[model samples]
Target: MAKYLPPLFTRLYLSLLTAIFASILLTFYLSEQFLQRSDVVDFYEDSLQVFIDVSSYLQRNGQTAEQLFKDDTVLDPEFEILWQKNWDANADCEHCKFLSVIANTAIYQLSDEQLLAVYPLQQSEEVILISDKPANSSIFSGDRRQQNSSLITLFRNDPSEFIPYLLLLIVIISLGTTLYFSVRRLQKQINQLVKVNQEFGRGELSARAQKNYTEPVNELAQSFNRMADAITETVSENQIFAQAVPHEMRTPLSRIQLATGLLRQRKLKCEELVLLDNIDDYIDDIEKLTRQVLTFSKLNSISNQCDHQAKQCIKLDDFLQGRIKRLVVDNNLSINLNLQALQLECDPAYLRLIFDNLIKNALQYAATHIEVNLKVSPKNLIMLTVDDDGPGIDNLQFETIFQPFSRLDKSRNQETGGLGLGLPIAKAATRRINGHLFVSHSHLGGARFSCQLPLKVP
Candidate 1:
């Protein structure tokens, strides 16, 4: 069976509230146990003495307690006093409980709310004294509880019993103990999974979740392992193919070049020379494709050693000025550059590669104008954009353009097209520094590529 797992924050918050509630109940219980009440003695307890005095008065006056009760005399207590002769019958009323005997006077608790006393007199007769409260308080005549609070005490259940509170304490303790262990166990398991995921994200392809886990968690871990396995396998195969193809093609390309050189040295017709020049062009394109394949393979492969600098902080204005000055741009195209003074944290080499690819891509596609802008966004991220004034790409092809060897313009002419590794390499560099790359329609009537990066490398 799959175990129920609550959200992490919800469980933590619920645990906190439960802890507070348990603490409050425990504090109330402990205070009630150790702290004394304000009223040490109530009126009912002082009335116990009244029972003894009434008993004594009956014995000395030579009067029966039952007779004293019939006559409204000055000896009558302000409290209710019960003087009954039918001891066996009254005992069945559930009102009598013998407490203790002092000086031949016996005390019995009556009806939970009153006290009684018995004193022996002249003829083996006994006088019973009961402290009076109200008529509603007395239920000494019924076998069952009061039905209407008066019909028979049929509704009576003592409120001072301790068992209910004891039961409640047990329930709270049991629930609290269960919740504590459950949340603790779940947190430990979640932390283990999160740790392995973090290791995998940090380029540790070997990191895998252990099988010693319960349902749902183990199931999710297995899914992640399967995905990682597929990625690792694909990357390994691509690397071998990219490296091997270039090595294999080098021999044929070198031989063809040598043959073309020897043919150029002899006298040749115009058409033959044109054919030789076409062969040279093909060789050059092949060599360029081979180098790009190897670069694409390296970029897509997962590795920790990126030759990234430990201190990633760099001045944006100086870096841009130096790299742009070195680039060989077309003379006819009008270039507009807008820059901001910013100190950014990133691997400068990776940033340089991304910037160079974007600039080259824009230069290749622009008709007459190119715009480059660098600034910081409101989210404290670095936003760098390159815009061109040429035929823009369709919005649907935005994701497709990032794939290696993808080209929108079907014409494979080298002048206007490329092997299409530039954007992919740029995207890879952006991901390495934990950044986002997106393409959209530009205000300049052509394509716009935007790179959004965090201030710090992560």
Candidate 2:
């Protein structure tokens, strides 16, 4: 389950989203604190102004403090005036304070409580002003201890109070969506690079990463493309060199064969004849090696052109009969055939190469007889099986034999004339025609080379 977790981009996006929300919450908290402090200061300043205005009105109107205090409806909506005939030096309320002798007025500011102002009037009477909404007596009644408790209650009760949280949520969603797409875009590019790497690893030398993107990934892609180009060029050069050397050596090898043939025609001693035969054998080996190298080179070169090659609809039985007839006459081996008249669309040239190598390998190794079987499978695949009566190969050597220059211990003997490339060439030719080839222990007492070619080559 853990293995199926989200990839790197998703994890990074989640981490970034977490950080964004955390920062937003911290900013909201600090802003709320600052605004609350400013509200407190503004409340006290407004309360002081109200007290001064009420005192000035009493002095100018020539109205007695008792007349102003008695008429509650005549007072301003936000201010309330209270008259105390005797000023109490010791009050139960800790917020009450005495005025100075010179000014005879003092303001008391209580933490998390309402602001209070006391003004001494003539006749030893005192006027008190409290900073709170006149409609709510709970402000100074000690029921609400917090300065903004009512506002806080209103905020909690209102449905629109989630606006800030909602806005923050919207911002987070927008950011996450944008980051998701950006990361997906990057992931797509990285996937392309990975696919190209996989193709190159699978032996498609032309595979390359795309370099048309922004920044770091693009730079890496460009570097990868450059490296692929260099490797491809080097491999092409090596293949060309390999092909050229064999072609060059073939001409000299033919000359050697011609010279040995001429010597064989002349009269020679038994020992000389034997030495000449050995020379002929060596020449034959070199010629075979040359041919195999050229065939391998051609197979490699043809891979890129397989898509462009025209395929023909050919009768499988007729083709196999002709090829088998030639093999029987050339190798003087008894070959049995069990073929169905199946029609297949493929390159005949590639089929011929594949069959020629497999049959030749069987002819060289088989003790007595070779059996060929051809049929059309239910899946519309043309299955071909070539079996021989000889010592079968080890199961471990199945894949090894399909590799270039890979020979079994027994086949390494000089007399076999096996250059260890027959199966490799056959395998390459099989792939060129979109076919599969494998070997197993045959019922005929030797190795069976089974090939399955798609009926319709594409």
**Residue-level lDDT tens digits of model 1 in 17-121:** 577677767877777545322111233344446765776787799877778878876554356666666455255435466555656655555544455545444
* Candidate 1 TM-score, true structure as reference: 0.65
TM-score between model 2 and native: 0.62
How many clashes in each candidate? Answer: 8, 0
Q: Among all windows of ten consecutive residues in candidate 1, which has the lowest summed lDDT?
A: 35-44
- CA lDDT, candidate 1, residue 194: 91
Q: Write the per-residue lDDT of candidate 2 for residues 1-458, one digit (tens) a residue.
A: 87898888778888888999899999999997787556655655675577677778878999877787787645656755566666554563454333222244555443333555555665566556454553456334544444454756867867586788888999999988998898888888888889999878655888888768777899999999999889889878988998899989978888888888899889999999999988887787887788888888877762465544657888989998888778765455688889998887878888898999898888878988999999887787889999999898998888988998887754644456467788899999898777899999999899999999987877
lDDT of all predictions, in order shown?
A: 0.74, 0.77
Q: Kindly report which residue stretches of model 1 are placed more than 4 angstroms away from their true locations once superposed.
A: 1-162, 198-202, 211-223, 309-313
Colliding pairs, model 2: none
In Å, residue 434's CA in model 2 sits off its true spot by: 3.7
